[model samples]
Every structure is written in structure tokens, then in C-alpha cells.
Target: MKFKDYLHFLSYAKSLEELWSAHTEQMANFGFDKLIYGCTRFRTATSLGDPEDFVILTNHSQDYVDGFLRNGLYFHAPMLKWALHHEGAASWRLIGQMMQNETLSAEERRVYEFNARLGVTVGFTVSFTSVSERSKGAISLCASSGQTQDEIDAIWDEHGQDLLLMNNIAHLKILSLPYTAPNRVLTKRQREALEWVGDGKTTQDIALLMGLTSATVEKHLRLAREALSVETTAQAVLKASLHNQMFVMEA
Candidate 1:
């Protein structure tokens, strides 16, 4: 698809799944058949927050994801390290250079070897510019198996700017959509209670608004806190707002 046409499609994407499906197909057209995109708003100096809170979209196999993310291999990924501290696109050749220079630790080498076994050897990582100190976003575009770094680099050399822009636009669009973490989706009632709370309603006020008893209002608030994994209703309101789950329009 043409660049302008793709931009228009991305801007109108109404959900993460729809946006990701189109994005993966576009990347595949450029020889990158595997893609992993991740964003976190809870990053800290020492960590990227709970994995559950991360917005991760990928087309990689479950096995690769199980090991790379579920097993915590991302903490030791060399390119992820670079992405944390830098912005813009970077070649996977840096991994080779790190190995040649013996700068890779044992754990990092283990991640490398694991990728090698899975044929996830060559790729480019695009680290997006963070909007805040506690936010980070990035995407890794892995070339199809049997493709070499040299060939991938040539492709990048010609069309890297366009690819980078598309990924950035996609990232921004994702942040605008509602995202609920796994096992943390708030029910309609839970969301309504939180929205009322956000609007400065007390328990009795919310009960009147929703035609429920004050006790039931408290129950909904309590469940909202639990679902968001927060300790209090105020925290639940903030977390829900951050994920764009409160007062959202129905589809």
C-alpha cells in the first residue's frame, strides 16, 4: 500500500487487534514476518513495571513469546537494553558486535542462543520517543528466516524512514485506544461505578445514579479495586482512567 494510504488507515483504527493485524501485514511486505510491539506507562528506573500492565502485540509463536516474555528473557535481551537508553532504529548487527567484543553476559548470550534456535536472528528494533520519564515504547521487526543482516540492512537503507514513521503512528494510535490488562477487564457495572467516583460521587450518590443500594455500590467499588489490582477505590479510578476504561463510549 502507498504510504499516505497506510497513514489514513492507521489513523482510523478503532481497536488494537485491527491495527495490529494491518501492521503485521505491512511489515511482512517488507520481509519482516515477525513483529513484537510493546509499550509500558509504568516504567521505573530498574524495571518496566508488571508484565501484565504492558501493551504487547506480536505475531511470534506462543513458544517464542512464552520464553521471551513469560520467562523474563526480555530483561536480558541486548537490543532491549539498547532500546531502553536510545531512540530511533537500530540494526541487529550490534548484537554480533557485542558478541565479538565479548561484552555479552551469560544471560544475554542465552537469549541470543534461544533466538538463534528459533531462527529469530536478524531484525531491526525501533525505539519510540518516550512521552514521559516513566513511559517507553518500542517494536522489533524480525526478518523472515534465512534472511541475512546484510540484506535486511539494504532494505532498511532504502525504506527505513517510511517504516519508522508507520510504527510511530501506530504506537500513538494504540495509546489512544482502551486497553485492559489480562484478567483485569472491568465489567460494565464496575466501570460505571468508577466513572461516577471519578466524577466526585459518593457511595450513596453512585447508588442513586445506578439504582443500586449503597451496599451494592460499595461492592462494585471493592470489585473494581480488586480487578485493577489496586488497594483503594481512588487508585482503581486512576488505573481505569489510565487504561481508558472509564466513561468510554459503547461501540
Candidate 2:
């Protein structure tokens, strides 16, 4: 499809349902049988212990998806981990197994084989502007079998850039809407702390500048992470930057 058609279609994408509906047709046009775009809300790096972030899964067999969730497959899912920070588009050379070099683990192989047995192989994954370079949202398109890396790259080379741009626009527009979380607003100190981190300041440096202890600086950052509603210090910095909550310090 041409860029004009993409723009025309994207105008109708306000909510996840609308986005998925458009993608269903879009994927079919590109000749695929299954697709899914989902996110996980993590309170900490170790725990996906809460209700997962909003997930909009479609086009896959119900049994396939059910098995994925029941087995906790994501922990070893390489593409899922890669999407946490990298943006743009990419395709695995073969079944998700192609990543089996140093990039994957024994457990990752076990889980992937679980899917291979079910006939789902190879994938193309792209992110929709994550909350942090370490963590954010991702969308993935999977092929049942017999997909080439070149073909995948061709798809990305054709639509990947546009998809990235559109997802960014969609994310900003969503955050700007009235349904924003109440705790999004950070105290001046918290914002200051986070902003400094964004600027590459160390805890000790920020502490020296703010007349606080390294431990005290850590406290402010902890609060900042809570207010930002993201997990990980890296994600906090990224979120603050996304929301314009990151601060600037004078030379």
C-alpha cells in the first residue's frame, strides 16, 4: 500500500480495538494468518506478578495463546525481551530458533520448541515507543512457517518506518487524552532528580548538587519511579523524558 493509504487508514486509529481491526486487515493484505500486539505492566524487573499490561491479542489459535500464557513462555521469549528497548523493525532469520546463538538460552530453546511443535515459527517484531529504552510497549507479527529474512526485511523496509512513526503518534495522542493516571504529576524534587538522571548524572553528583545524601538521592528517585508508574531506574528516566518530567541542570 502507498503512504497516502496508510495515512488515511491511521486516522481511524484512536483506541486499541480500532488499531487491531485495522491491523487484522493489514496483515491479511500482506498475507499472514496470525498477529498480536500486547504489553505487560511490570511493577519490578523480576515480577510480571500483577495483571499484565493491556494485551490485545488476535489472529492466533486460542489454544496456542492459552498454552503460551499457561506455560509463562515470555520469560524466555527473545523477541519480547528485545522489544523492551530497540525500536524500528526486525525479523528473525528462521523460526524464533534462529536466535539460538549466544542470544538465547537453553530455557529459551525449550519454550520456542514448544511453539515450533504448534507450527508457529519466525517473527517480525517492532516497538511502539517504549516507556524506557529498557522497557516499553511492543507489537509483533508472526508467520506460521516458510518466511525469509529478506522478505521480512522487505516488509519492514517498506512499512517498518511508517509503523514506528505511527505508533509514536498513537502513543503521544493516547497519553495526552483525559484518562491520564492521577499520580503522573511528580513533585519538583522528584522531577529534578529524574531529569538529572536523564542528563547522565550519577546519584552522588545529583546528591552533591541537591545538598542531599546518595541515599537521599536514591529515595527521591524511588519516589520518582513510583510517580512515573514504571519499573526500573532506567525506565523511570525514560518515562520522565517522555512526559517532559526530566530536569535540566546548569553548568
Q: What is the lDDT of residue 13 in candidate 2?
A: 48
- Candidate 1 global CA lDDT score: 0.94
Write the residue-wise lDDT of candidate 1 on 35-63 in tens digits: 99999988998889888888899999999
**Candidate 1 vs. true structure, TM-score:** 0.98
Model 2 ranges with Cα > 4 A deviation: 41-43, 94-103, 132-135, 144-146, 166-251
* Candidate 2 residue pairs in clash (backbone atoms < 3 Å): 41-53, 130-136, 195-247
lDDT of each: 0.94, 0.62
> TM-score of predicted model 2?
0.58
Which tens-of-lDDT digit does each residue in 1-251 have in candidate 2? 46567556666545545655666566656545577665543436675433333333567787877766545786567676676546766576534445644556787787777777886666577666656423455666776467755776677667667656654554444343222233567777887887778778999999998999999899998997787667788987765554433443322
Enumerate clash totals for all models, in the order shown.
Answer: 0, 3
Candidate 2, run of 10 with poorest lDDT: 173-182
**How many angstroms is residue 62 displaced in model 2 relative to the true structure, after the best TM-score fit?**
0.4
